[model samples]
Target chain A: MNSVVRYFTDIYKGVTSLWTGMKVTGKYFISPGEIVTEQYPENRATLKMEDRFKGEVIMPHDENNQHKCTGCGICEVNCPNGSIEIITKKVPNEQGKMVRAIDKHIYHLSMCTFCELCIKTCPFDAITWGQDFEHAVFDRTRLTRVLNRPGSSLKKKEVKS
Target chain B: MNEEAVKKVILKEDEDYIINMGPQHPSTHGVLRLEVCLNGETVKHMTPHIGYIHRGMEKMAEFNTYKQLIHLTDRMDYLSAHINNEAVCLAVENALEVEVPERVQYIRAILDELSRVASHHLWWSAFGMDLGALTTFFYGMRDREKVLAIFEESFGSRLLHSFNTPGGLMHDVHPNFRKHTREFVKYFRKKLPDYKNLLTDNIIFHNRTKGIGVMDKEMAINYGITGPSGRGSGFSCDVRKVAPYGVYDKVVFREILYPEGDSFARYKVRVDEMQESLNILEQLVDDMPEEGGYTAKMKPVIKLPEGEYFQRVEAARGEFGVFIVSKGEKYPYRIKFRSPSFSNLFVLGPLAKGGIIADLVAICGSLDLVIPDIDR
Candidate 1:
């Protein structure tokens, strides 16, 4: 008699658990507003990521192409993946004093872990982040981009008004 | 046989044969080995042999720079690497007195939740497979792959994203990450019921699991089972709810509870926890702050101040902790990791006794033992 009661109680609990779970499933399954899916490539334009999402390493340059990078090797030294390589060359200013410039800023995208250590190490806010996440290439050489602005590498200082 | 008659069999089948079931079995999850003494198909005693994957991470942490050690953490519990990274970063930041930007903190919270969801997805999928449901395995991978794609877009790594840093985040959030998360959450919200009807409501699976591996509230606490496993025993020991690290305190979410403390109950608890995580993710995506994403900055070599710092996060498994002792040098003095799987794996012996050997896999699955975590 006791075993029978135990058995029925177990059955009751199992039934309740199943019914409760199924009720939730049934409700969600049949709901009108329940359908939620987006086709990946089809919805490419609308593929949303958070505004402040961190994606890739970027070096920011001013409109005049004057960069904040001081040719400081801090970013290169701090990178865990050894992806950043900064080569400094000194150029003579109008005042005839030597001004250090970053000759070649090489970033190997393949080896880069994107841990952001380079950004953290930059005392100057020279390197900002970019969101160009889809950087795959048919050729591996496309990943190693030199850190130099196209038109103007570094603009010369104009006379004060 | 009746109780009196069963005494004869119990007495006669004394020295049961012991078969070791892991440190290698796919069902053991990571690297846990269970020594099971069985009388025919019935389990007499079960002891879990662990520490095979002990990387001496804590001791190694003491020697490596805080920044270098963060990478080391990515290996400890490889499933939820982001969460592991976040927990250690939180502790290091606390010690350094670095204030994370509001936006960064919020994003960390969001990513942590995403990690939780992903981890649970694998758990549910693997748990189902362990119990003989092969289709759930494919479904799990399909759903999991979507999140990994999103992760790759957001953090540039699939399995182990060391996105979180000591001071703050490496960079600001990607513009697409929020939208990606929103869509992912929406997608998972729909996929959940497909999960339910496929596995949860199955009468046969329920029969196999319901009464097996029962652990009440007291036994659960004593055994140090945590995360969903402990909660299945009615202990709401979520560090997010209790301690409120990162941005969890700012939001409202339910502490999912299952009072029965059985194998089925724990399994059900994880499924509910995933829903709860989705709910939190929805709220977080809707209201992610725009201010403060990066901390001030750190040295190039990533030096640390001298002191001991301990940080704990509510990982999908349980309390994932990192204890770092800095010698005020480039490298740490010591680093000790308290993984949830380690403590949770210790309970297998008591759970397996008197249960059928077939139920061994089921009970282990319910506990969600990720062996790398136990071994680490």
Candidate 2:
């Protein structure tokens, strides 16, 4: 008789416990606007990434097609994976002395882990992280991008002033 | 009733059933295969099969520089990625004898606690689903998104953030870091009662979890279970309290323990921990210093002195320890990661010995084994 009474008590407790859980869910069910999920494709136009988002590396060039990269290969060395390659060419400066200058700043998007090592280690502050995350390409060669534009030169102090 | 007839009948009785639970099954969580031997519904004996996802991180650590090695730790316990990174950084810093600023310590603590809450939320969700209550999944993820958003805003990546460098953060946190963290704390506190109502107080959850997979204190210590799982057995094994790191010594928070030593006890430890994490966040946000260098004056090249250095940090899961054997080179000579899951996963065999097959899933979920951390 005691066991039978305890069984009924257990059933009562279980039902009430389940009802409490249901009430929490029921409140969310009635409010249609409380849904937190964003429709990703439809909201692409207004989708804003954080300012510090490490999507991809880019070399910032001025209006004169002059960049700050000295092609010292610090970024290339610091990179855990060999994602950045600095191809240097001997170019005569204003003093007529041949010095190493960046011929091509090759950035392989496919190989990059977006670890921000290059940007953090750059002595020249030439490279910065871009906001473009859509890097899908059908061709593999398309990802091996040269960061500095063709015919671009090193930015002069006068140009900055 | 003769001897030959009796012997034949005994031999002809069915052998114990053997079954493989997972290397891909959802309940196993990651690529962990349990070769479970069963008699009727009860598990007779179990052997865990690992190394499906082993990337040989320790061997790879030998080739990479200490700074580069910090990123590799991120992949080990990807849930508590920041804390793993901190372990490596702390080991390197301690070896180099660099003094990390108080501000850095405070910020690291804040981030650690935030990740703890996020980790517990996911665990709670997944544990519920493992026990056949699917509603907890959506609620857990919904609340977890806010914390991940905070991580995404500050660290620039949501999940595997190698934010810690040798002595300090790679960069200072976002200007709105404190504001977002405080808001998340206030917001999460209100929502926690809903979590309790939905799962903690539910009788179905209790029936599924209570008195299942009982691991006593002696067994937990013997098996080296070191997180909330061990604390569930009242082992007093919180690395934070044992060896305080990253402003943990300064904070006033209880090391949650329960002497019940069952699946439910482990579940309660994590649930109560989330509130304690909120308390930690509340204390940290207001006191964070406005001005400080994000990183210490680290040389461009880092080389640890000739010795073995170890660091242990209380990760979301358990005590994550990094052992570095340096030959005074930029790269460590040999690296060994004392990952929590590796120790914790082996206990499943002992815990699930007499429990039903369904209860095995509950025991495994309560243990909260992350396979990458184990396999790495």
Q: What tens digits encode model 2's per-residue C-alpha lDDT throughout B1-376?
A: 9978985654323486878999899999999999888888988888899999989999988988988878889888889998998999999999999999888999999999988999999999999999999999999999999999999899888998889999899889998999999999999988999999999999989999999999999999999999999999999999999999878888888999999999999999999999999998898888889887788888989999999999999998899999999999998999999999999999999899988999999999999989999999
RMSD of each: 7.7, 4.1
Cα misplacement distance, residue B125 of candidate 1 (Å): 0.7
Give one clash count per candidate, in the order shown.
Answer: 24, 0
Error of 1 at B169 (Å): 1.1
What does the lDDT come to for candidate 1?
0.79
TM-score of each: 0.73, 0.94
The 10-residue segment with the lowest total lDDT in model 2 chain A: A152-161
The chain B TM-scores of all candidates, as shown, are 0.93, 0.96
Q: To one decimal, what is the Cα RMSD in angstroms of model 2 from the true structure? A: 4.1
lDDT of each: 0.79, 0.91
